[model samples]
Target: MSPSNGIQTVALAGVGNIGSPLAFEFLENGLTLSILTRDTSKADLKQYAEKGANLVQVDYSSEAQLTQALRGIDVVVSTLPSGSDDQEKNLAKAAKQAGVKLFVKSEWGLDYDAPNMEPVNPMIASKMQLRVELKEVGPPIFVVSNGLFATLAFSSFLGSLDAATRKAVINGNSAQKFSLTAFEDVARFTRLAITRLPIPPAGSSRVLRVQGFAASFDDLIATAEQVGGNKFEVAHKSYESVADKQLEPSLEGLIAWLLASLSDGRGLLPQDKLTHDEVGFKPSVDIRKTVETVLKA
Candidate 1:
């Protein structure tokens, strides 16, 4: 099918944080959707079915069931968790066998193609491996790079700001900018790409780069303080300290590496222009408003 043909039927595998919103976006765009879930008994999963989505309960390990569920899907969006590489590979193979036209991978973060990129995060390393494997045998893939999810940046994941303690950690240069996208914006842009992105002629795929906002850590801290109506006690962690911590073998090391990467601007979009220009859609989320909402929540 050509890009001009447009997407009609879409299937989503793994509807959690990102997938749930993407499924809603697909339905909001008036596209036919099939949501594949392992647990149909969950209230959230049932809610989608109640709202007219075709819910297919299947085992991720069952290739036959996966292929059968994806038989008529024009596009397959996998929003599986970071460590679910094997499940993603399985879905890719099923999509190829089921003749799905497009396969959107679960990459909603930093530009994997950035220069001198290293697998500091094990999840990113797994994603890189999946990309290579899909290129060789999977269906046509669309890689969406939406920088860091704004929600995660302010959460405990990056260690930049602690909502609980009302504390902040500044890594390296406080003025270095980092790209961020609200989770809602990610869903909206993804829906546009799946339904409207032009199909490559052949032997090619699409890489989308998008960001909701870009600001320095200092700026983010200020935003947090303004939104939360409280002053945070700030501390500094040098890049060398974080980088050295990253060299250790543990989850803490992984998080340290991630902080160092974001501090040094290694895992962000290379440019300021949003990929929405290519899709002809404008993102509407404001970073300040989003931070305020998150803080209030």
Candidate 2:
């Protein structure tokens, strides 16, 4: 568990999968939380208000609205998707002007700053570009690079061909090792970092690459087999064969880029110098646990 140093009053930009759970985690930690949404009367956020989050209405497109919404906020945690770089940039600009103490960028996936990376979707590239621009901002921004969400991959999207079938289709080999963090755990870590000190100086733009466990896809398959009480068949498909059919053709290029990244072992997490011992974030969920839960589900 990460310690909170009494800093409260934080804001979240996007409150979807990771952000929704993150808001709950922050509330659990007793932080004075607020969320900026397109609509303030959203029924989804009503429960969050009951949980003690001040849901504020903001026109995500307007700079004045965002700036005014963030007037006295101490920290900002942005979970906006990669395609929303423009919104993130606007938020960064506003946070800087508002004298916010910390801003956590919406970099929950791969480390886009890694050297010699191939081009991804233009939108993703724009997000990386936003990081460089944020460096010029006055407040310190933290970039968290947790590989993949175990919950997401285990869901029907990446795991099975169909939800009902529970048939997992692997592109290449199931033996490729990758680091996976649970969505809930990612939220927990984000809240912990939000209320805590900026471990690495804002000038350096610290990157926290945290993961609960690193395991191969074969490990997940075997675990699924054990939990299902039956041996499951592993179907291997070429990236070319499944790229267009399984994924949208519009996103095929991005899919191939991400697949190549996994094949090259870029999906594996590097040995980060800032661990729980150094900073203070140790996620409790592991890939095996995530796999087990998916199987039971």
* Candidate 2 deviation (Cα RMSD): 3.1
In angstroms, give how far residue 247 of model 1 lies from its true place: 5.5
Q: Could you give candidate 1's per-residue lDDT for residues 1-297 as a string of tens digits?
A: 223457889999878778888888777778889998887777878767876799888888887889999998898888887777778888888888998888888887888778745646665676777887876666888888887888787787676877667888887877888788887789988887776777653334677888888877787778888877888899987788887786555678777777877888875687744678777667677678767767877
Estimate every model's Cα lDDT from 0 to 1: 0.79, 0.71
**Clashes in each model (backbone N, CA, C under 3 Å)?**
0, 0
Top of the candidates by lDDT:
1
Question: Clashes in model 2: which pairs?
Answer: none
Model 2 is weakest, by summed lDDT over 10 consecutive residues, at: 241-250
Give TM-scores for every candidate, taking all chains together and pairing residue i with residue i.
0.92, 0.88
Question: Which stretches in model 1 have alpha-carbon errors above 4 Å?
Answer: 1-4, 201-203, 247-250
